[model samples]
Structure formats: structure tokens, C-alpha cells
Target: MADGILRRQIQLAAANLSEAIDGADGFQNTHQSQHCESAKFSIEQVVFILEKIHIMWESVLPRSIYRRSMFHVLGPVFSRITKDMLLIDDMAAEETLQLQGLIHLALENLSSLFLSLVENDDDEKFLDHHTWVQLDESIPSLKKFRKLAELLDMSLKSITAAWESGELANCGFTSSEMRNFIKAIFADSPLRKECLGWIVATPA
Candidate 1:
């Protein structure tokens, strides 16, 4: 019964976040320089919901359960953003730059929030744990989506270097995802072709 309630709460939060993300389509299409100063509304909504969860459940929930629940809430949220926003074709460079800045701010705020919620007892255990590590860095889809966000605004040279250095794979990107993102963000060119080939030949 308790688990069911928790699940419902998480689902509700996820739904709210998805709605916020859907509503942000207009903001995303425009060059909202002011909005990028903070996180996007959708991302801020996530942080707000998570903060509520931390306040309500942190004392009652087991540490592992609390951590897992947070990820459960975030997984769908990140997936929605990745699919609807990040994978767009024909995004202008200015838009990509703004999006990346928002992403970076979102990540920073999330990391800070996660760290603040860590209990004193958890300090030693989580001493080396970045939020991504503590919250489960093994979620490849989530990590890859973030990596793709960073890659979105990078130059072809930097991207190829990252691919060559295995950073993309290390960040949990699949070959297909890498290729698709490249195709979506960049135009056809010799360098783009070479990068795509490298992505295919190299194991992700």
C-alpha cells in the first residue's frame, strides 16, 4: 500500500512535469534569452516537485528507496525532454546554445539540490558521489541524453574528437544515437560524414 502510494505520487509529479514541458514548446521555439538565465519552466517544475518529495519522504523512506524514487521520477522527465526537444532537426545555433545553457543550469541546480538533501550519515558514503553517481549513473538513457545536450552545440572538430576519444561511449551514448544527433544538428559535409563513419565503426 505504501509502495503504491509512492508510485502514484511519482506518477503525478511526472505528469505535471510532462505537461510543463509540453507547454514550453513556444518558449523553446523562440530565443527566450531571459528564460535561459534560469532553468526552463519544465526543469524548474521538476526541481520543485523533487524538493517537495525530499521534504515529505526523506525521514520515512529508506535511503535506497528514496534514491530510486527520485530516479523513477526523473527518468521519464528526461526521456520526454530528449525526445521532444533535443532531437529536433533544423535547430538554429543560437537556439542550441540557449538550450545547452539551460541544460547546464538545470544540471547544476539538480546537483546542488541533491547534495543538500544528503544526510550527515550519508556524507562518508556519498563523499565521492556526484548526484549522477549517487542517483544511478548506470541509467544509460539518462546519461546519454545529457551528453547529447552537451554535444548539441559543439563544433564538428570537438565532436569528432570526443567520439574518437570514446567519450561518447563512455557517457553511455549508442552509435545510433550519436549518428542521429549528428544528422539532426549538423549539415551534410565531409567532416560530418567522417564523424558518422567513426561513430559506426567505433563501438558505443
Candidate 2:
């Protein structure tokens, strides 16, 4: 029963996180006038889910269990999502480094949290505070990435961690290959212009 609830909560968290991240303006200079409505809609969806979640858990689990474990487990992940979206949407060029740093840190933290949960031998046990994200790729179902889209829907931080930890890459590739891959993924993305400008500015 607890496991089921945990899974459900994980899914809801991932969905809200995905919507928030996806709906956020990609450009640093996007004005609120352009983004206000989407932002409001995304936040409202998350709040609605959260309110229902509070009610559902209140009914299903003991008060002590909800207070002790769910709060701890959900809070960090929730905080990470909020920070990630805000950072990703920041338009100020002066804060680029700060944004990147937040991106790196949040992803690592979320990854660690996920690894702890997945590797936990006991489904009912709560983890300690400082356990780091493990690089283990043998985690089944997760290995094939069959669950990646859904997992991303639930947790991009862990997804980023998994990517940075090399669960997604098959072999070493040259920088050219990496560049080509990036171009393919972001060809129509906002990053496309940046990539083109870099290429144009580079020496032959």
C-alpha cells in the first residue's frame, strides 16, 4: 500500500515538474506579459494536484508516516523543480553562470535522491540525508530506458543525473559527433541560434 502511494506520488510529482519545465519560457529575455498566462496555468495545475495529494495521503497513511517520510521525500524534489524552472526561465545574461550552477547542482541532488530510493533494499525504509546519486546502470527496466519518458515526466533531475552518470551514452564519441547530436536535438530549439553563432564565429 505504501509502495503504491509512493509510486503514485512520484508520478504526480514528475508530471507537474515536466509541465512546469516545458511551459516555462526558454529565452532569458522573455517578458512576463508573454509568459504570465502559461506560468499561471502550470502553477495552478501543480497546486491542484498537491491539494488532492494531501487529501489522498491524509486518508490512506497514518499521520505519523505522512509527516515523517513524505514531507522529507517530497520537499527536496519539489524545491528542486521550482528552482530548476525558475533558473531555466531566467532572462538575465549576467546570471548565466549562476543558472548553470543551479542546473548542475539540482540535477545531481535529484539524481542522488532517486538512486537512494531505487537502490533501497527495503521498500518501506526511509533513506538518510547525505546519500549520493549512484552510477549503477544495472537497475532493470530503467536500463533499457523503456521507462525514461515516464520517468522524465516524474523526475528530470534524476534523468539528468542518469545522463551525466552515463546511463544513456553507449560509447565514446568525438566532439564533432556530440556537436552534431546537439544540433539535431536543438535545431528548431532556441539554442539553435546560439549554436549557429558559435559555428560562424569559430576559426576554420
**Judged by TM-score, which candidate is best?**
1
lDDT of 1 by residue, 119-184 (tens): 445534333446455444634456766776678778887887888798877876567766777886
Task: Please give the range of 10 consecutive residues that has the lowest summed lDDT in model 2.
Answer: 140-149
Give the per-residue lDDT digits (tens) of candidate 2, residues 128-204. Answer: 44322222232222222222222223232343343345543432222343234334223245555555444334313
**Which segments of model 2 are wrong by more than 4 Å?**
26-30, 85-204
Error of 2 at 56 (Å): 0.9
User: Please, what is the TM-score per model?
Assistant: 0.77, 0.36
Candidate 2 TM-score to native: 0.36
The true-structure Cα RMSD of candidate 1 reads 3.6
Supply the TM-score for candidate 1. Answer: 0.77
